[model samples]
Each structure stands twice: as C-alpha cells, then as structure tokens.
Target: MEAKQFQLAEELRKSIRGIVKTDEPMAKHTTFGIGGPADLYIEPADTDDLAQIIVWLNERQIPWFVLGDGANVLVADKGIRGAVIHMGKPFRKVKIDGEKVIVGSAAKLDKVVSATVDAGLAGLESTAGIPGTIGGAIVMNAGTYRGQIGDVTEKVCVVTTDGVQLEMTPENLQFRYRWSVFQEDKNKIIVEAYLGLKPGNKEELVRTMEYIRHRRNMNLPTVGRSAGCMFKNPDGYSAGQLIDEAGLKGTSIGDAVVADKHANFILNIGKASATEVKELAERVRGTIKGKFDIDLEYEVRIIGDW
Candidate 1:
C-alpha cells in the first residue's frame, strides 16, 4: 500500500502544480490536533491545478476528501485511505469589486470578515470571528444569531468531480441552518465565491466585530484544543445550555474533556485520542437524550476511517 501510494504521488506530481505528501499527519492540519496520518495529502496551487488534480483522481477512481481549515472536523485514529485535498495559502485570494467581493474558497473566514469590514462592508460584520475557511463556512452556512454566510453569498464557484467548474447561485446552494448543497453533494468542490455587501461606516463595523469576538471569547474555551462547537442546537434549545443543564461539564474520557467554559466544546486537555473524544461525545449525547428527550445532532464533521 505504501509503494502504491508513493507511485500515486509521483504520478500526481507529473500533472498538477501542487504539493503532495505521503502519510501526512492529519493532527497537524486540524484545530482539534487529534488525528492519524492521511495516506496522501495534496495541496493544489490554483484553480487550474485543483481541476487537473481532481480530474486525474477521478479518472484513477481514487477516493478523495476536500479539507478546508479543518475547524469543525475530526479524523479517525487509523487515518484516511485516500487523498486529502487541502486548499491552503495559494487559494486564499481576496478581490473586492465595489459591492461584491470575489474570494477564493480557502480564504480564512475571520480574515475575510476583517478585510470586508475594513473596506466598510456591512454584510460580513455578522460573521466576525468564525473559524475555518470561507469554503467550509459556506458549506455549513456558518453564522450566529446576527446572520448567516448564505445571506450575503451572491454565488459560489465549484468544481465538479469531472473537473467542470460551475457557478452556482443561491437557489443551487440550498443554504439553511448549518447545511448546504455541498453537504449532500460530495462530488462538488468549492473553489470561489462572490458575496454581496452594502457600504457602511468602518468604525461601526469594527465595533460590531469587536463585540462579537469578545462575546465568543467569553463563552468558548480559549485555551484548549477543540473543534469549536460539538453539537448542533436542537430546534429551539441551545446544545451547550442543555449539556450544562445536564451537569455534564468537565466530563472526561481520558484526556478528552467536556469543557467547563462551554459544554458544547469537547476539549483535548492532554494527548487525547479520537476514540476517547468519540466516547465522551456519545456519553454527553446519551445523557442529553435521557434527560431531555432531544436527539442532538453533531455539528462536527467526523471524517476518515474508523
């Protein structure tokens, strides 16, 4: 398998202008800092590079996963069998055109928010301190009570499995509460997006972002390694409040602990394994279900092999 993987990497190098690594550690890429090595980790240089790589992989029937900033993600301890396509620095281009901003999918959500806010753009102010890349944010429709990314999104550019680039409008995106068309359509890779914004006072935008940041910092665990929020809010109730109410805070399974600061965040206080985190999450879920009769859905995206 190692030999085949090496051969695959060499073959991929021949066609695409990107970085390719064998047995790349997933731990280094994710925010949680808990994961095994991926068999092949790839970083495409640009849109054309990405398209070429995708087409090559598709032709070879290679299983691949699109990885963003790895914020709300968990990979298995045994790692992944196929390629992990990471849209890194090269894909983080941001171009502002009057009321619309054209940005690459890999642009950091916070950085984009800051940039747009600095430019006196009002729409992205609500997204303030959200982690992960723009691609991941759009796919999950990430937002707070202020607003959602989908609300400002004019269109999204995605590359299909066949390497065909398509410009998708709001109707095609199907954005709604922590969900998007990309969640269901694994074959589509987000490349670029256009966001519509209104002109506003830069001072007001800065104040709004600062307030949001302060609020988030006050509620979330700032010191520990975590994949942000663990569970999606169940309808009308907040997941964190439910877990806290259930007296599950500070709960631990090995080094994986339910954060005291925010019950929704399962933190890696020490050298926590994926299995430990999974068990801890399950325990939290069971307790919540038994107590409230509400089945909390996972906001974290668990990937790779078990």
Candidate 2:
C-alpha cells in the first residue's frame, strides 16, 4: 500500500502542472506551526486544474483533503496519507461590481473585507479581523461582532465530488452557528462566492476596521505561532472565561502553552510538536469540564492522521 501510494503521488506530480511536494511539513503551512509532514501536497493552478486533479484522484481512489490558509485547523502529529490540495493564486481574485462583490474561494477574508470597505461596502466591515479565505469563511459561516459571512453571501459556486459545477443560493447553503450545508456534505468544494453588500461611508468603514483590529490586538495574542481562538464560545458564555476560571492559563505541555493573556488561545512557545499542543488542549478541556460540567468545543478544525 505504501509503494502504491508513492507511485500514485509520482503520477500526480507528472499529471498536474501545479506545485507538488512530498513529505512537506504541515507545520510550515499552519498557523500553529506544529504538525507532521504530509505525504503529498499540491497547489492547483486554477479551478479547471483543481477539478482535473480531483477527478484523477477520485478515479484512483486516492484520498485527499482541501486546506485554505491553515488559520482554523490542527493537523495531527502522525501526518497525513494521500493528497492535500492547497488552493493558490488563481483562486485569490476579488472583483466588485456595483453593490456586489465576486470573491474567489482562495481570496483572503482580510483582503475581501478591505476591498469591499475601500469600495464603500458596508456589510463586511464587522468581519474585518477574521482570517482565512472566502471559502473557509463561507464553509464555517464565520462571524464576529454582530455580523456573519452568511448574512451578505448571495450565492456560492462549488465543485461537486463528481467534478460537476454547482451554483447554490444562500437558502440552499443552510448556514447556522459556524456550520453550513457544506459541513454536513463533504462532497462539495467552494470555488467562488457572490456577496451582496450596501454602500457606506468609506471613512467610517476604515474606522470600523481599525477599531476591530485594535480590539483583536488587545484581546488575542496576535504574535507567536497559534491558531487564533482554540475553543468556541459556548452559548451565553465565553470559552476563555471558563478556561481561566479553571486555572488553565499559562498551562504548558512541552512548548505548547495556554496563552497567559487569553485562556482560549494555545500558543507555541517554540518548536512545539502537534502532540504537545493536542495534550495541552485536552488537559484544558478536562479541567474546564471537571470544573464547569460543560464540554468545551474546539473551534479549530483538527485533521490529518491520528
């Protein structure tokens, strides 16, 4: 099986005209900087290139996972088998047409928000500090402050598992609380999104973005290797507050430590392994659960082997 997988990776390298890598460190690509290498990593050139790669992999029964900017994920220590597709430049395009914005899935949320704000668009201002791409934001229905990505999204273009293109409206997406229909159906890959926004004062929009940035800087640890928020804030309560109450702040397992400033953020002090981070997270969870009788749900997506 190992030999066959290697042969398949070689075939993929020859067939796809995009970047292909073997034994690529997942830590380098992730926000946490703490994961084992992936067996195969490919960054597709465009939607057509991506579709072709997917079709080839599917035909051969080769497993694959799509990754965005790695802002909201935790790859395992044992690494991953098969292919990992990281969408790149070709899908990072963003354009504004009057009150509507057409954003490629690979386009960063920060860039999208900034572009819309600069164009006097109002609806996305509250999402200014959010990281990752449009596709990830849409997949998770990413929200902050008082607004969510689903609120402004008009339609989404996705590629079905069978390599068929699908254009779905907001109603079809069925978004709610950091989840979407795409979360339940793993056979869809977001390609692009159409957002409906309204005109607002450009200066005001800029001010709003600045304010959000300031707030994030003060509340979250913007420095170091950490995947933003580790746990989702439970209903009517904050995860950080609960973790802090459990006395888990500054807790450490190897180089991984709960942020002294923010209990919900697990920071990599230096050269932390995926194992260390996972252990620290579990310890924090156990402590919180023991004290509060509430299981803290992880906001960061954990993937890869083990």
Candidate 3:
C-alpha cells in the first residue's frame, strides 16, 4: 500500500467505531462469487458511524461504494479501489408501529416482509422471495407484477455526502421502474425508511406471500451462482422471454452460461471471470438484436476497477 493509503486506513480505524479491513476480498461479499479485492472494506457500527465515515472519506476526496446484499451486481476482476462500505448488523433492525413499518436499510427484504405479515400489515407481499437488502430494494424500486417498494414507501432517512441527515419524501425519491434518485446520486446513502401500509388479514397476507414465492421459484433460476436477472424488460416485452424465443438459453462462454431455467439469468457455472460473463452477455444482446431488432438493457450493475 502507498504511504497515503496506509495513513488513511490507520486514521479511519481510530476515528470510527466500525469493522475495517485492508485488501479485503470482494468475492466473499458478493453473491456471484466473483470479483477481486477491495482496497478498504468497512462495516459501520450504526447510522451515526456511517455518517461520520462518509464525511471523512468525502473530506479526503477518497471514492467509496456502498454494498448491500450484493444480489444485483457484477464486480470486475480488477477489484475495487478506495473503499466499500457495508451496512452490517447494526442496520438490520425492524420496528413495527401500528400501520407503519420502520426498517433499517441493511435489513433483508424477506425478513421485513415476514414482519409486516405477522403484524397484519399488507404492503410488502409482492417482494417475497426477493434477494438483497431494503436499501438495495429501495434504490432499485424492487418489485414484481403485484406491487413495488415505492408503493408503500412514505419517506426515508438518508445521510448526504456532507454528513447531513435528512428525511426525504417519496416525491424526492422519484421512484420509477427499477430506478430511484439514489441510483443517480452515489453520495446519498439510505439509513432507514418508513413504509405506510394498510391493515389486512394475516392469513390472507401469508397466502399471498407464499403464492408470490411459488411463482418466483417456478420461473427464476434456483440452482446456480448468479446475480439475479441479467437484463431489464423492454417496453412491451419480457427480456427472459425474448432470450428464450431467440434460443439463447444454455449458451456458454468460458464458465459463464445463459441459465436454462431463466433466459434472463447468466449463471457463473464455475470459475467464470468478469470478462467472460460480460462477453457472453454482449453476445446474447447481439443475437437478440439481430433476430428481433430490439436492444436489451442490463439490470445487473457491472462495477469495480475495469
């Protein structure tokens, strides 16, 4: 490590109450089982500590990236520079207040769904079986055909890059199909969110959640190392269906293969490199475009130093 980088890591360790590691392997954190090492990996103790850490990094002009459950991203083989911040256990609390649900950003989506169902709150059933953290769900506006997180989100507590905390309303969030303001602004970090839900029968909510889970299992690739859906649905068509119709399923480049079960998913069958997966994805896109003249957009984020 350079003198400047070493100095920054040592100073950060003393200043914040969080877990800090240098040259941490990114493969251990992501679901795809890929990626190289991160220069600095941090897990903030709490919202206050997270805010402090962000401020310090900003002041130093050091770049950082936030990692949630690591469900929808592809990290490069060259790894990430600077820092990677994870919310950790401290940010996994869920509080139920009558018809409102206050959940920390690091909380898992399925756990929050279960909590709401148990409390007779009916809003998050559509997100059952979805992978990743609440913060990731909010950033991506995660959803199914039934509903989205944006539908019940009233507001969220966020820390700006300047160390200022603010509660932003839904209007400020600007949630659309798989898009949010957070996606555009890397400096704005979510702490927690308030969801307003309606009272419903617990039994009915449970049934709905179960049904959603069943549907997802039936269609999604279940037995592989993957980063969820590879491509977003086109305006009037499903990306999976298009790939399926194009007979691109089971296509392979190195160890990266198009999932047989779900054409939209690209599976890391073995020791697939990031470059291999990206090349396979590009090939799929080219084939689809040539056949149908429709371009496919990636839903999975490709990140790191490439």
TM-score of each: 0.98, 0.96, 0.97
**Model 3 scores what on Cα lDDT?**
0.91
Clashing pairs in model 2? Answer: none
Query: Which of 1 and 2 is ahead in TM-score?
Result: 1
The per-prediction tally of clashing pairs is: 0, 0, 0
lDDT of each: 0.93, 0.87, 0.91
Candidate 3 per-residue lDDT over residues 86-124, each given as its tens digit: 887999999999999999999999999999998889989
lDDT (10s digit) by residue, model 2, range 162-251: 888889997899988787898778778898999999999999999998899788788878656888889988888899999888888888
RMSD per prediction, one decimal?
A: 0.8, 1.4, 1.1
Question: For residues 71-119, could you state the per-residue lDDT of candidate 1 as single tens digits?
Answer: 9998899988899999998889999999899999999999999999989
After superposition, candidate 2 runs with Cα above 4 Å error: 1-3
lDDT of candidate model 1 versus the reference: 0.93
Q: Rank the candidates by lDDT, best first.
A: 1, 3, 2
Worst ten in a row by lDDT for model 1: 215-224
